[model samples]
Target: MDKSHQTKAFRRERVRVGVVGVGGFGRSHLGAVESLASAGRAHLVAVADPFREQHVELDSRLSAQGVAWHSTLEEMLEKETLDAITIATPVPLHFGMTRRAVEKGVFVYLEKPPVPLLSQLDEMIAWDEDFRVAVGFQLIYSEPIRFLKQAILDGKLGTVRSIRGGAAAPRRQSYYNRASWAGRMSINGEPVFDGPMTNALAHVLQNILFLGGGDAWSFARPTSLRGELYRCYPVESFDTSCVRGVLDTGVEFAFAGSHAVRDESPHTLEVVGTRGTLRLTGGTFSSDIPGLELPQHAGSDVPMLASVSRFMDYVCGQPETDIIRLEDTRGFVETTNGTLVSSRGIFPLDARFVESYQVEGDPGLDVLGLGDLITQTITTGRLFSENSAPWANRTPTVTREEIQSAVLEEWIFGAEENPKNATACL
Candidate 1:
């Protein structure tokens, strides 16, 4: 009985689900689970979080739901016989937690970035033949985005020439202070790999990839990339990133993101093609081509809920549909990991370019010329290095082969590859 060929028996009754990690973004996963419960598509049988008692409000809310809780995941798993589980744990915990659930034959809805390292992702994908695992890239599940995808496939926008996407959101020091591992590249010598592009503004990056074609593996893979990573805040990882590359399909892709900028620009993904252009800004989609009519959808489900519901549908024997399986995100994992591997060293801005300010009575950091840089890269489809940003390095390049080599050596041969020294071999 090969594990790849093994399939979990479909549960005909209401699928019983559980969630792990109920803090930070976990609350969003819970809200989506509650939506599933309300719709009678699934039942949340239990929850697990070691720090639940510290947050009295969250504790009270879970109590109100009348579901059982445990201080640890082991306890919850022992008590509840769940058909599926949604993992909202930290990036460091994702691989192990999801692996345990999958080995136990439980279906999983895992949080984004799937896993921090490429080797970990490869292992998970190898065993996910039955498609029991769904990675939570919520925007891909949005009805509007899906419609736009089909429009592109239908040639409504013609051949995509280039893509510009990013988000300009600011985070105060308190955000990094929320957890011991917050904004850290590594915790206790293991990869947490949390940063602006990989975590916070990940949706923007993935949207650009998805818009290119198929899933992350087939459609969105970049042939080559140049990235400028900068840190305005005191963290091991960069908070501001600008990346530009050409996908294997030859479509140009550019992404700019920051947690240091002010609210000067709306988050957006604009696709430019030979025939027309399509833009998604602030959750609404519009295009320059006239007479583009989107079919009306049943009111939108909170992206997380929509994803959870679809996973539940699969568990209940619903015929296979176009859900975002874990393997579909290989291209995304490669891109993010490549960005981080290339962005290994912390290039802090000069004191003159950094501005200290009070954001909601909390300390914040902003770079003087970041906004213009963001806009310029998006407009011209150029990497920061090409645009001659003063802070950018001399021709910083990140290749897929380099990343794959480092990750393989680290994860397989047990060699400690220095992620920060990505240019050492070069």
Candidate 2:
């Protein structure tokens, strides 16, 4: 064959990939892999999900695509010599599944909120000898966020003073009811800490920590954290939280997240510096610095696709330098664990301040004036307790070491009981 034809043939040698878990967000991972497969960048070899039989349409869809299905990851690993696997399983299952894949000498694209605890993360870091694991903190791959990080390193945001971020995406009772483990701190004695900061809106926190890092590839570890956690929903975990802390780099940071709000607000991240400030909201960036020009190209409209493509690139021999390695997320896990420990426990929000409403036939609980509280917290870079919310109480700050050594079950099961007489306002 000619030189050009030889190059084309070589390019067609795609990385073989399998996806574990094909429900909810897992389906998104499957779709991204399929997209890359269609482009000759990857081969979607197989997928594993014990609950696959329950999803008939999805089963037929996969069948039609000539993709193999396994009831478990063990079966998939035993049957296929896959190049890599993307794990989109529950928070508790991440570490175990990643460990299995690593043992089999396979690369892993672990879905985010990497794990529910720091100890689990440390274990993964210890055994991932070849740097074969990549966590799916997709926003780190976004053009705007990438541009922002480089700008910080280049002294565009001179002497970065602080970073603040907040996100308010309201969830209804149906949301928590979707799965047996949803919103639970533990399921069947396993840590699943499915709260806003740790689960649904985790990208915001991850981005904040990533931006706070002194270097481009590093994430700033939290030295100390203080948090106020409250739940309007009757779940084991909090529905609303406000965390304030200091990064190891001495850059102060604050974040607020909630699933108990009436209207959805854009996820916002603001970085303040001595010279100027940069603000990112709803995937767009703005700044007070005159003549600051960001990259004209927009990031992928589908972040998961971008993340999967990048992982495939790494699997197909690209440099690992840009990948979100497991170690890059220590700060994120530390912040998450510390926030929970600092809160002592998730408080039950007073029913007097909580209103019940139907959003498209789903029962949703909204904290009265929560939108205002979220705005105030983000604007002032303060925790909800410091902002004087009637239901808010400040918990003592906790150190990273304390968080690492803490037992999650002690806090998960030891929370104050909900008031039986309290009823949501209609």
Candidate 3:
């Protein structure tokens, strides 16, 4: 082909992508793509949903827009040669789909819960960095969250003393009822309830680890818990919770989430240091110590956008500054894992209840895998399952090795580099 023809072809095939699952979140993903793709920011190549007939809007729009459609993820994978995929499928399918795509050399913009098993995560991390894998832990991507992270790295708050955060959101039975995997321990065969710590509150915890810890937060220590804790139908998973925990550096963090509430309150936090404090409300950034408050927005962008953009930029080989490194997420992931253990009384900051409650069998769910799996299980029944963690009751503890590996990964991903000096990343 001539140079001009090749250029035209490049333009024609600019980063083909596929989205699996078309539930509310899937619909949101499609909408975000539409906004960007029409402006040439993305190319909406195809979408897959087993219930295409139920979603008249999605079906008609895709058909009318000339975007191809598939009834199942495997079908989409086989029929369309895509550069990347935004998985909107169940959590159980996450590992399978993501592993397949990356092994096939396709970039993957996976939803939260990027497979919970550390072993699985390590294997995925082993993929050629050439095939980028971006997780939807979007607290790092939130404009306000990012700004706060900058503030922490700037040392405006001094050595971090503690983190206190809570996400008070509401969910109806309709939420789980509408989706097969909803509120279950596993959908198909994958474990569900990656927990509020990993799912709804993941964005919050991700921010805390990145902004407060200076990207060296691989170390994690779960403190303790309190209040209204119960797993709903599926009774096998947590439905509502409130817990208190502390990080390795003695920074205390709290979690409050419930599936029974009728209304959703704000998800916010206050990061306090000896010098001052930082506050985040609805993903907005502000700090009393730094003396800065970012322009607040009326609403936060869907968490997926930040990660999606990150995936795209990385896939295009954008400069390091733009990428959300894996190491950064390691802190986030560790922090999340800590919360799960803490909440369940498996790992205790207080140690008061260490022997009070008999913890159940190990779910051994990777928090990330659980979140994606929960999302998937909730969205679909027969997809997104991973093996349970047999050690849930074994007491949660992080080896120095775990934290080190997470930090090392973040360093490689530029999460630990001085935010201002992106080039110094590991």
Candidate 4:
């Protein structure tokens, strides 16, 4: 094709994209958008962030790129001509902001745990039928995970029996201190329950759900759940969580995660079935199935950039399929909500169990044997309570209705129905 024709074709396919919250994780989104724009897959037209002034470097960079900046998402939505918007805002702000963008007829690429509450997730799911929406469960789009998903469907694992997964990673105090709602159980009566399961190891949980159902489009909803939550630091939500549940399909699921571990362990998910077992951790896959050959791969199993580019393609109607769907996250979301409801309020650990550390001049907390605790939970398919932990309370029997009640409490009342003894998290 001639140069003019090629240029015109590129312009015809380029999607006009804006990013909200151009700081912290939002900066990562900006980098991806900018990369795509340079390649003519997208046009980064605008950026929105209330804290743009605080991030002078990010502000100047966007300005140099000729992208307009707005203080709030609403302002950006009103003033900018955008075909799509990527939301990397706070947990509580996700649903409302994404809703506004969707209502404006703009596609959305939202950050993880799409929204804090199940009710909000449901609303987004309903709106998804009419809008192009992609959540940040980016691992689903990774080549390795995609290949493994296909293997499961090919009966590589036979009839799946159970799944166990865990992520034990330490976080500095700066992580919680980053925002007013960070590590909070609720902010001004609104649920902002951030913690290990929903934030750090959340991708692991989502990957487990995807594996349980044998595909990206058929994630399994938890039939029931029992778990324990703990906070070793002075936070509102639990920094450590161990949960066990059964999927509606009768496959067992158990997960444990902690932000209080001393060292970062490779986040792992193990799928056990009648025929064989498959384990995935840190992009390494191993299986015991006879004749199974693991693919040789390098680079990240995390597919954030790929997901962003694919989302832009999806928005432009070039890719007719959604590699990641908002509805697929419902099972993970409901199970997380059920964990919160089934547990007695978050239990703060005795100070003796917590040791202080400093990471690059930032304060952090480490729970003694957090790694062991998580591993034990995964191995035994039990929660901390089920293992006879000295600090854990007996997990309550939780009904799906109880889960809905907790969600409704946040929707109507905005905070935990009973928050007196709850520990903050993230």
Measured by TM-score, the strongest candidate is 2
lDDT of 1: 0.74
Candidate 2 TM-score to native: 0.92
Ranking of candidates on TM-score, top first: 2, 4, 1, 3
Deviation from native of the Cα of residue 362 in model 1, angstroms: 0.6
Candidate 1 differs from the real structure by a C-alpha RMSD in angstroms, to one decimal, of 4.9
Q: Superpose all Cα atoms of candidate 4 onto the true structure and report the RMSD in Å to 1 decimal.
A: 5.3
Q: How are the candidates ranked when ordered by lDDT, highest leading?
A: 2, 4, 1, 3
- Which ten residues in a row are the worst by lDDT in model 4? 1-10
Off by over 4 Å in 1: 1-7, 57-66, 214-219, 284-286, 290-301, 407-426
As for TM-score, the candidate ahead, 2 or 4, is 2
Task: Give the alpha-carbon lDDT of every model.
Answer: 0.74, 0.83, 0.52, 0.77
Residue 10 lDDT, candidate 2, scale 0-100: 20
Which lDDT tens digits does candidate 3 get at residues 203-224? 6556555554536223243333
Q: What's the TM-score of every candidate structure?
A: 0.88, 0.92, 0.70, 0.89
Q: Candidate 4 on 331-416: residue-level lDDT in tens? A: 88888888877775567676666778777787777777778778877666878767766667788767666776674354224433
lDDT of 2 by residue, 212-293 (tens): 9888777898988898888778787778988998999999999998998879998888989887998887767888987788
Output the TM-score of candidate 3: 0.70
Q: After superposition, how far is residue 7 of candidate 3 from its true place, in Å?
A: 20
